[model samples]
Target: MCGIVGAVSQKDIVPILIEGLKRLEYRGYDSCGVAVHQDGQLRRARSTSRVAELQDLAAQDGVAAGTGIAHTRWATHGAPAVHNAHPHFSHGPGVDAPQGPGRVALVHNGIIENHDELRAELKAHGYVFLSQTDTEVIAHLVDLLYQGDLLDAVQQAVARLKGAYAIAVFHRDEPHRVIGAREGSPLVLGVGRDEHAGAFFLASDAMALAGVTDQIVYLEEGDVVDLQLGRYWITARGEVTGRFQSVVREVRTVHAHSGAAELGPYRHYMQKEIFEQPVAIANTLDAVTGISPELFGDGAYRVFKDIDNVLILACGTSYYAGSTAKYWLESIAKIPTSVEIASEYRYRDSVPNPRTLVVTISQSGETADTLAALKHARSLGMLHTMTVCNVSTSAMVRECALSFITRAGAEIGVASTKAFTTQLVGLFLLTLALAQTRGHLTEEQEAEHLKALRHLPVAVQAVLALEPQVIAWSEEFARKENALFLGRGLHYPIALEGALKLKEISYIHAEAYPAGELKHGPLALVTAQMPVVTVAPNDALLEKLKSNMQEVRARGGELFVFADGDTRIESEPGLHVIRMPEHYGALSPILHVVPLQLLAYHTACARGTDVDKPRNLAKSVTVE
Candidate 1:
């Protein structure tokens, strides 16, 4: 995943581009660069460093321009270096075009799958490449096609591309405009004060243009947009067939906050997001004054009535949320449920049911694999599609027939704390809606569920109070190299999430298993050196979970347990237990995960690792 920001303004845009890149840094990138048209030529500065470093480099090089494009690149075709950094340029096809030196400068996101073939063709046409990136080919290709009209040349050049990409192109010959195109990738346009009197902006996400401008337009797939100093237009294209058609779409305002992502009192975004769960959950449920099918979207009741089963598609943390929802769906709604890792689901052949309600869960909602999987499911005639996502303008929300927008704000942490919890909140609502529609939920059951939902924020706050205890446990955890987490019944997915949080932030090798699965070979790895963390909720499976804990204890394994107060698990010499003040029953996973998040946060702090922006991790997985 990479981030792109471009602007055409009358004012110097170097600082604006740098600030935009800093905001989009959570998208994850190895190097940063910026290119601007100034002094009748193109000026650029690139760095194999953070955006701040790139800012300093640009300032040192005295590079400033009013109209420019910036990029924060996550290496795809080549290793991370100055040469591979974006804002790549191309002169043209011939020696005379090379003398121009700044015929084209472009910043691109996503992989060009057919770049190798295009590279060979361009090389044969006397085009020389300066970077080992698939993106550089676009610069040359656009340059070769440029005959004066930048937007038309860009449209023609992108017509030859395959795979996902969101790019902003700048041509020295047409310095007044910035051309942006997206196919299977995310792109947005920002409208300034006026259509013809102010600057126009283009970025991969609204976050990049948040403080700069709140009026945002999300570009659909195969849409090429033009951003001029005071005017902009969009041309929507179709890649389904070989022929391309262009149509203009409307501009929509994005309700986003540039300040919400600030760490404020917290040291890291993970911690801030962890503490924000109470607020996030409340916001996610705020629209549900009383649960109904409309809470998801209009006509959701129709989709629920027609569906006989549920198929959830997601990846990583979102997948775990879906996995947790499977228990709620089958038990409450009486609907058979299946959860699939989106990446694996698309590649494998499986039985398809037209009556299956396909639900996709994602934080960013632009996850490439999950989006592809949704399309794959659609192609199989499963038309009932719904998404539980935080970002409202994301492709998942736009492409789905229905959607529930989670108000998790902005999750800047790469490990994902609040987003996961908020997703569970949305999924629980969906479960209740389906159950109510099927008459599976009685009046009393509905009222009780509503009360529990209303009290979830308070329950999560109570769990956050146990942070000091969890932090104490984390001190010992930081000394370990491997970990195993255990949970029973509905909480098994929570155990998996705990293990994921540990490994993702602390870099410790961790694994999770259903408590009953200990006899199936995971127990063999349980030694004194390996710490076993167990989720002991006061549910029907508490007795069985105790038995599993006993198995681990018998193996001389150190045990760290997060147990409900009524679980009857006392702390002993070899057995460590952090008691949950209350038993949250069906919604226990939302409460149980808070301490695990604190554990991961403190453990990462103890290990001096980057808790918020972990190594080799991006907050948004825009690519497969």
Candidate 2:
């Protein structure tokens, strides 16, 4: 996982490149560097720190470059260091190039799974390398086989590439053009007001290009593009080509959808997103009003007419949403639904039939595995593919047959909060649609469900009022080195998600187990020194959960219980009750989840971790 940006501009491009990298920080990086060709020489700065020392160094006076390439690297092939940073360059590979600098420089993203084999081959050809990165191997390989044309040489080298990558390549002779290509990861070209006066910008996320310009053209898999300031040339893998239609029209996403944001008043994006949950939930419900007649109301009762099964594929928080939706789909829609990790789903040989609908959930709509799943299922002739996504114009939305856009605006945090809730809202709507399609719901029952759906935003608002209480609880976890979360029924999945959030950002060893399974195994890990958060809302499993609580208490374990307002969880001894709004049942997970999100957020914030960007995690997993 790495973030890359390159620009060929008439003006000095160092400032623009650094600004782009700062926005793409969510992609997670151990080290970052930026390289610009200044005064006919390639100059760069890099470091490993939260301070972005590389950008600071490059921003000083006398640093002037018209063309540059920048990278925020997540270490995979080498230790984080100045030497191993990107813009990997090579000249002494084999025979010198017929043209250019006898060397090539490139910034890459994604793992070249066969890099070891490729390196060994090049080494035998007398190509020596300086860095341990797989990317370094590419630079040498390209140079070893270099011909007169740089674009052809790049395509030749890429033909040997085995895994995912998005790269920005430049040569000393071809100083004005930055050639880019992608097989799985993301790359875009940002054009400015005066065409050639603009820059060729490439990044893993659109946010990287947001400040400089709002216009962009995204690259498709197998598409190679050659760019100068104002012009872009598209080509196929082997032959020169161009897209039949431009990325969009002259209008700014005129025929597209987008999320609005208010970044003016928050200390951190996570805090702002947490406060936006209510509106986000409402936005998801509002979208249902425009659902196809065949998918909503009485007219939409035939698509699931004979459907008997469902599959949900997602990653990270979206996968947890799938887990919660499974509970609802089985109970409300009476459909046998299976929740799957997107990476595992495609690798398996199992295929869905025409009667089965596949749902993909993602916040950015660019998750690599989830997109693969959608492709794999559709390739097997399952045209019934739908996506619940936050970004309206993401690749997933464009690829899926049906789409549900989540209302959660800009979720800058690596650990999702509002996106999780909004996805659940979309999933619930899909479940109700399935029920209507299967003829399992009468008009009155549908109305009742609609009313319940309308109440969710209010419920979420009520949940938000508990932030002060959740903040108080953060103290116990701020210094915690390990934690355990337990729940049963629908809330069991929420427990897993809560633990995952803590682990992802806080680097705590957190585990989640079904309350009933505590005695079977996890109980052994429980101790007075460990914090065990139990989700014990007054649902059907409340009494059974109480039994599990008793066992923990008997084991001298510390407990943090989140329960309904009227529930009888005692605050005596070592127990603490995080009281919920009221007697919540199946929907309690959505409400109960807010506190845990807050807990993890504050814990990471208190620890002074980059709660928004985190480590080794991109907001959008554009590459697998």
Give the top-scoring candidate (TM-score). Answer: 1
lDDT string for model 2 (1-624, tens) is 478888888888777778777766755677888776665655667778642677667766355677778888888788988778877767664445322333577899887989999999988988776788999888887776677677777777888899888888877666767778787777766666544355666666666777566677777777677778667677664334532223322213211121333355876778788888888888767756532334422323454664568889999889999999999999988899999999988888885687777889999888888988888888887776778898776778878767778877777677899999988877877877786666666788777767777888888788788878888878778888999999998999999999998988888889999999998888999898898999888877889999999999999999998888877887988899877776555567788888888888888878888787776676677666
- Alpha-carbon runs more than 4 Å astray in model 1: 93-100, 194-196, 238-246
Ten residues in sequence with the least summed lDDT for candidate 1: 92-101
lDDT of each: 0.90, 0.77
Candidate 2 accuracy as lDDT:
0.77
**lDDT digits (tens) for residues 1-624 of candidate 1:** 599999998888889899999998877788999999988788899998789899999999898878999999887789999988989989765544553556789998888999999999999988987779999999999988988899889989998999889999988888778999998889988888743248988898888987788888888888888888778888866556655466767778776788886879889888999999999999998878887999988899898999999999999999999999999999998899999999999999999999999999999999999999999999999999999999888899999999999999998888988999999999999999999999899889999999999999998988899999988988999999999999988899999999999999999999999999999999999999999999999999989889999999999998999999998899997799999989988899999988988998999999999887778888778777
Index of the highest-lDDT prediction: 1
> Candidates' TM-scores?
0.97, 0.91
Question: Model 1 lDDT vs. the true structure?
Answer: 0.90
Model 1: which residue pairs collide?
Answer: none
